[model samples]
Target: MTIGVALIVGDTLRRRWHTDSPGTRGQEFPLLAAREQAARSTAADSTLASQLTLPEKPSIAVLPFQNMSGDPEQDYFADGIVEEITTALSRFPSLFVIARNSSFTYKGKSVDIKQVGRELGVRYVLEGGIRKAANQVRVTAQLIDAATGVHIWADRFEGELADIFRLQDDMSQRAVGAITPMVEHAEIERMKRKPTHRFDAYDFYLKGLASLNLQGSKDAADEALQMFYRAIDLDSGFASAYGNAAFCFVRRLVNAWMEDPKKEIVEAERLATRAVQYGSDDPVALTSGGFTLARLLGELEIGEQHLHRALELSPSYALAWTHRAWIRVFQGRPDEALPDLNRAMRLNPRDPLMPGYFSVMGMAHFVAGRYEEAASWCEKAIQVQPKFLPPLRTAAASYALAGNLQAAQTMMSSLMQLDPRRRISTLRELYPLQRNRDWELLTEGLRRAGLPD
Candidate 1:
């Protein structure tokens, strides 16, 4: 609510640091137990400085750069420049860049570089502030040793706004060039990092990503969607936020959580397009855009390409992985979706939507006509999230398919009691299955389970 003044990448922002309490800061980061093993690994090249040629392989997070330009109109341009730089840094492949959502957690806040390093599981961090005036832009960047709280590299560039692309490429190349070997040597031992904050819009986005892992009740998923919408309202031009929100809507539509899948898909389309238009360069927007198009519109080729480009830009995105997994399941390759789902689960096991992922697995099995397996997975989902909705619908169908009418009816009754707006018309809209096989499988069970819809 308090939109305090804050600086970006380089100049220190004056906003109250989110972690004002030493206790909060201490609770935010745990010691690098994983790094301890790396420290004692007894490197063949004992001197890190001497062996600087060994790719630094540090995973750096580029926090959101503030649009310090006087004109609010220039905000998008500044953001585009920062995104370009982040993309370029991610390209090194040897260097891992934290997902933008995670980095944006520090936006508008005063942060301790060491705390950031520890929280994000990076040995170093690259951050700066952007100030643009007239046609000219100034970007200041610095690399900090998260462990020692020292700046390893710092530089400032003043250039025409039109030349911002050139500046991004140049800065990113130098930064990557500087840390390549150190990152590589340190890569295997690195623990993936994310910010510890939980209340802000940025944190909400991360939680939204985590929600993609849900095993199945609609409760957590609805919660995630609210967060995504909240984030978008907080920053309308925040394309990634919009993109994810749209994608979540599409997921709800596909899984029959909505009363009208057709109408919801239309809304999903609009949100996805808004994301791309607003965040043309943001990997998150691109990825979510692709996912929405693929899942809701069923445009496989273009959607797949967009998703691929997004992954290329931000490979560590757990949501992207889950989206890809969902795409595969729809493509009739249920087996293939498993690995991607597994990866997402591993990345954030405690994600809010974890039950959804488990439910997806269950749905895949049920659709594949493996009723027993579907029931088992649905049970697993129930174990994780007792009130999740998708798994409930899935269980109803799975049990019905297995000829357990009693159990199936029980789930159906629970669903109706929890949400009484059930009717065949509403169910049809919610589960718009174009495929005969999919329609038959889902519809038959629901009908058999005695749901009017």
Candidate 2:
């Protein structure tokens, strides 16, 4: 059997790259579209400020299966196997499965399993190859501990191609059953580390999400907005992209990164409206759209409704809890919001956005007039993500209200350096605090820090 060089393109869909040399194996390159590759590569390069903590739940990603048959046509079958397994694993709420789009980006690349674990922030990696001969197919898979490079399980399944779908399902179930107990047992001895595998719209959305999650600088935020826009271009009905794009605008507004707040707000409203309209069934989209409305557009009533619907759809959705907590703060119910925020942190203990969660927790404390506690939580958030703006501002306000003028001024300077335009006068307009007392307290603290009125 002679194997030649092959180039693989796309995630779920596979295309063959023919080489001039037919008999010898040549180096393989993932031939994803140029623009998509650029965006993904750029997103990957963004300096991660801190190592992301491993999720409390067992997180895993199934890499694209190798086409061992040496036939380009068999690439589709291998991809299908991974896709089916990933989807099957996602049904378990306890298992954090990296979405397919993010995972598939590693296809055709020779990556170290440990590095793959760090890049994706997953504790376990599942890798395998597929071989097809005549009417029969053989699938081999192994699960590895990314942190230690230890093999937890390995197995092979063989069946006729006519039963391909059933074979895939059976293989998935077997793999899941084997992994579940191992993960649960390993939970006691270990703690740590995950990415996605998938299509044009989804791939673009994942890239956009990655950019947004970095939240390192204003440029990253702008890039995320553009990526989400591209995702929407690829699929006009991609509600999650719209939701995320709207959330990007909200991020810009809060961070004081926007050059034109009014224009961005209008854009945010439009995107949020579209997300709510088209993604009624998607809990993540609904929650993001709802947060944009309530926090940025000040549409509390409608936002609350969307958030409630989102929670109904996904009771354990950590992000929905985060959004709902914000709404609770707006309604002048900080006490209620704090517990909800805590729940979010518990659900995703090692979430990349934990800093945001901590900062919001400080906001809840601030609203409740617990200035000292607020400052403590804000400082904790700042220690994790020094570049993040909200926590800095919250720290300043909390310090000021607690009568620590020097610390307050230092925090204020940090916030000003991050976004020079923020001031006491600006806070009233941009911040959505429905209670007059809440607004007054925030401004008074900022004014005490010597911000211009």
**Top-scoring candidate (TM-score):** 2
lDDT of 1 at 316: 60
- Deviating ranges (above 4 Å) for candidate 2: 1-198
Residue 330, candidate 2: alpha-carbon lDDT: 79
Q: Which segments of candidate 1 are over 4 A away from where they belong?
A: 1-92, 95-179, 182-238, 251-264, 277-280, 298-302, 350-352, 428-434
RMSD of each: 13.5, 12.5
Q: Where's the lowest-lDDT run of ten residues in candidate 1?
A: 18-27
Model 1 over residues 140-235: C-alpha lDDT tens digits? 888888789888899998887556556676677667657764545232222111111122445455445545434243555555555565555455
For model 2, how does the per-residue alpha-carbon lDDT over 95-169 read when each residue is reduced to its tens digit? 766655557768899979998787767788999998988878888888889999999888888887655555555
Work out how many backbone clashes candidate 2 has. 17
Q: Score every model by TM-score.
A: 0.54, 0.64
